[model samples]
Target: MKKLSPEILEKLKGIKAVVFDVDGVLTDGKITYDNKGMEFKSFNVKDGQIIKHLRKNNILTGVITGRDSRVVRNRCEELKIDFHHHGIEDKFNVFFKEMSRRNIAADQVAYIGDDINDLPVLRIVGLSATPADGHYKVKEEVDLVLSSEGGKGAVRELADLILEATGTYDLILKKQ
Candidate 1:
């Protein structure tokens, strides 16, 4: 347990919920398209494991994305993340609604996102984060900048960061 300088360690301790924006933050922002207007995405397995651990710890986990896809829904279901919002334009609104529904407050939330669309919610969250390869604009305003790139282990990296900061990661690992 080391002292946090940016007040990051303190803020992280109070985080009861963590929100993620899909596409850039989770999937490397790459969209694979087909001839008939279909799209595909890739999600890392390590990401699922980490999110599962978060859930097991009872720290809320959620996903918000602008695009609606069955792939996203199915993966969330498999990961046991029922708090998800998709096809959303005003992400902040959806985020607040979900928070209210879950009985969570603003200061209890941590948001991780990339791109301009994500900046609004990121600004208001207790702690904000972005992946290493995220847009500079997005990265510049965040509270934490992860070393890992998105879709290539970024989610796991941040998840592990949170767990370790909260002093739960090592406990879980010991149980395993």
Candidate 2:
């Protein structure tokens, strides 16, 4: 993980929720089609592992993606994400609605997106981030450019930062 500046850490401390864009942010932006026409995507267990801790600490989690797939749905379900929306064309609108419904302010959320489609929501979040392999345009817009690539440890990296900034990292560890 790259070093987070004091300013970034301060911003992260206010984050009450974390939202993600699926393709490049969580799965390396790769989609596999089997001969049987089944779709598959690889997700990092390390990323999944930290979600429960976040929830335990009262930090909400969610997924908003343009594409829809059973694989992605299953993963979100398994992780017990607070919100999951798929096949969304206007990501910002959906994100805004969800946050509004939950009474969460834009400045209380962090978003990680890897492509242009994710720009609208990313720009409004309290802290925005991208994977190391994210598109150049996206990397430029985000507050943090994570060292790990998508489907590797990008989400975990961000999760770690959030946990630490919120002063819950040691609390989670104490249970282990």
Candidate 3:
């Protein structure tokens, strides 16, 4: 994990919600399909593990992706994410709507995305992040560039940062 500067820490402290872009941010931007048209995407358990803590701490989590897949939906369900919207062409609009619905301000949300399509929401969010292997443009636009690559603990890294900043990580560890 990269060191968090005071400014970044402050931003993380205000993050009441964290939204993710699925393909490159959650998976490794890879998709595999069998001859029978079955699709597969691998997600990191480390990433999934942190969501429970986030929820326990009352931090909202969501997924918004341009592509729809049963696998992704299943993962979101398993994680008990507060929101999940797939096949979204206009991500910013959907994100804005969700934020409004939940009464969460834009400045209280953090978003992680790895592609150009994610720009609209990333740019507007209070804290924007991307994986180490994210597209160059996305890396440039994001507030934090994670040390881990996609599907290999990038989301966990971000979640850990948020937990640490919010002082939830220590509390969780003490309960262990």
lDDT (10s digit) by residue, model 1, range 116-157? 899999999998888888889998899888887888787887
Candidate 2, which segments miss by more than 4 Å at Cα?
Answer: none
lDDT tens per residue, model 2, 42-126: 9999999987788889999999999989999999999999999999999999999999999999999999999999999889899
- Model 1 residue 147 CA deviation in Å: 0.7
- What's the TM-score of every candidate structure? 0.93, 0.97, 0.98
Superposition TM-score, candidate 2 onto the true structure = 0.97
Q: Give a tens-digit lDDT track for model 3, residues 1-176.
A: 35778899999999999999999888998999999999999999999999889989999999999999999999999999999999999999999999999999999999999999999999999999999999999998889999999898889999999999988999999999
Q: Which wins on lDDT, candidate 1 or candidate 3?
A: 3
Q: Can you rank all candidates by lDDT, best first?
A: 3, 2, 1
Worst 10 residues of 1 by lDDT: 1-10
Range of the 10 consecutive residues with the lowest summed lDDT in candidate 3: 1-10
Clashing pairs in 3: none
